[model samples]
Target: MSSHAPPARTHLLIASLCLLGLLSTTGASLPYPILAPLFAGDVGNGLSAFLGLPPKLLLGIALMVNPLGLLIGSAVLGAVSDRLGRRRILLATAIGAAAGHALTAAALVAESYPLFLLARFVTGLLEGNGAIMRAMVVERVEGPLRNHALSWLNGAFHLGWLVGPLLAGFTVGVSITLPFTIAAGALLVGALLAASALERGTAAAKAGERWWRVARERHAFTLLRHAPLRTLFSVHFAYACGVAAFYEFFPLWLVDVGGYAVREIAFVNMGMCALMTGAALFAGRASSTEPRRRASIQAGLAALSILAVGFGSLGVGLAAIVLFGLPHAYYNATVQGWAADQFAGYGQGAVMGLLSTTFCLANIVMALAGGALALVDTRIVLVLGGALALWAALAMRNWSRRAVSVAAQAVELR
Candidate 1:
């Protein structure tokens, strides 16, 4: 079936998948620009009063819920997509995400904190299409083209991050509830595009294999049992922890410490996103070798750590944030490429699901920890996150050396 398709159709399929990724990321990030001020009783027409909880605590819970949902969704839907087919999962989840976003908007308008949290959770759960979409990309393309396709998808995600906050900033000025609605509409568009463009590939199930059993068999926990895969997952988890912490609280710091407005935050993020996109593209082209990829990852981690510590002066800090983008892009592209090479045989959906679970778990920890630390000093959270990234960089270096030694010994024996 795939062989007979026109090149145009294939290109359309890839474009649609990338668009879906962009929309999903944009929807996921749409709430961030205003969340701090809105929940802190500083914006959104006193929305925080309805929650009757401390702003930091409420914000923490709100942030934590999404990753919790992502953890479950990535584990469950990612595995399920393997059995049920990627197209179907993508279709369903995209629609579900739209609904969740609508609900979030309604909750905001009605000032219902619990409803808002539930909506965010639902959105995260349904956004598991990331893994499914990645699997679809893998199924449709192969060889160098596959890597390029994945890089484009990653770029799409960064592009979304670039645009989402900017849209939120504009919309919030008009109406705080508007961004959610806009995100919902965009996701709906993605769903329609997926429904039209995506082709269902071979399902992962064998004859008489129950769906639940298949999901359990491909669980992220099962993947962790492999030594090399485990090492990779650990490194990814550590990096994600730091990134999540830095991202979630960085806005809060900007508002509280740097005295920046939402528009200014958006502008800074736009610069970061631009750099990130450039870095992703450069990494895709330049870091093709294993040794180079490892070096890129190490260098990125070190730069990230240094940048986190240098956020005292707002101007300097914003510059650091922008510069941090290069390393950020390098680490993400390198590690993701390495993981793809390592896990291509285990079912792309399953592998991506496991990776998503690792990311979500890290986000959950950092969200809570960052929030608590913010009460004392936001700088502490940033420092701790930097320390974690540095540790992971050191750990990856050691692991790489051991892997090289083992390979060398195997070569000698052969």
Candidate 2:
């Protein structure tokens, strides 16, 4: 690992970026454990019961707005990075998003739903630096070492998912807004790290079109119009929908159905994310039809988890939740790597942006759908998620084949 990488600058950049991933993601996910407790911990909190809406419905809206901002940001931010320079944009976003978190905490203190949602939206918009991180890796790291660097980077993100909720669960007892405040500080530290450790380098303008023009002409949604990418996007969307359902409602599942408290739910997430972190470290290794295989494995596990959580006891639910991390890591890594490898011609930033938007879009869709279903039963929401995952995983080959055939027909017609 040490020998293949560039001597000092590259080494520090990767190290800082990895640390930034962990710290920033910790800040990002800190709200996870808090949301369930604050929104649904009891029958309803002031915010959750705001406007006399159902707790789940209110939670759904809270969940939806952040990813909505992400969908918008991922679509547009790549172009901004291209024009502004990735490091500059990243450092600015990291700091800006930290302030956004502080605003979010203020909204919570004020019990203002509108402000809270707006804060979440703006925070997500700034946090849309995933593409920037990927661009940095590709630009700075050369050869196979890039993959290794990416694995480490991804592992840091996974670790953040574990640590964030864990910290929130333990500390939320001090004050409801405490976790968010801590999260804000974590992100500030990460911003400082990025500013100090990273080099201030400008990207070479690759194409004639400036980033602003590119932003207007080609962005995340436009990827859907590309025939070859349609198949890829479809599969990724389905997979993302499944994960989104599981992520958004599982805590509600534990809190309402399983009689678990926020800390308990956090423990469940910690176990799952821990497994995810471990799996990610090795997920970059060999696998046959890796993208398909990974998705299929995840779909199967997801289906099994649905049964375990819905029918089995609380213990079963806990088990299912924790176990999901294994396949999730493999599935995410393979699909992302596959997209990068297969569609680099589309522009690496664009491909990565597509993946981010798809994930964000799925989260938005599932939050609304799951919120509605949770009114009837949370279990039902989990089942629908499983169905989507299954369809994407089991029918992948046939769907892709059919898509290719359709593309061929359209070409002939033209």
The best candidate in terms of lDDT: 2
What's the distance in Å from true for residue 325, model 2?
0.7
Question: What lDDT does each candidate get?
Answer: 0.75, 0.76
Q: Write the per-residue lDDT of candidate 1 for residues 1-414, one digit (tens) a residue.
A: 122235677678879988888998888878876787777754544356654667777876786787678788888777787677777778988999999989998988888888988999999888866777766766676555666667777878889877777788778888877888888898898788778886666664678887677666776667778877787777778777877777777777788777887678777878888888876665655443564247446555544644554355776667777777777766665666566667777767778788778878888788778878889988778777777776777777777777778889999999
Model 2: per-residue lDDT, tens digit, 70-133? 7887886765665557778788888888888899989989988889999998988877777777
Clashing pairs in 2: none
TM-score to true structure, per model: 0.87, 0.81
- Deviation in Å, model 1, residue 265 alpha carbon: 2.7
Q: Per-candidate RMSD vs. true structure?
A: 3.2, 5.1
Error (Å) of candidate 1 at residue 380 is 2.8
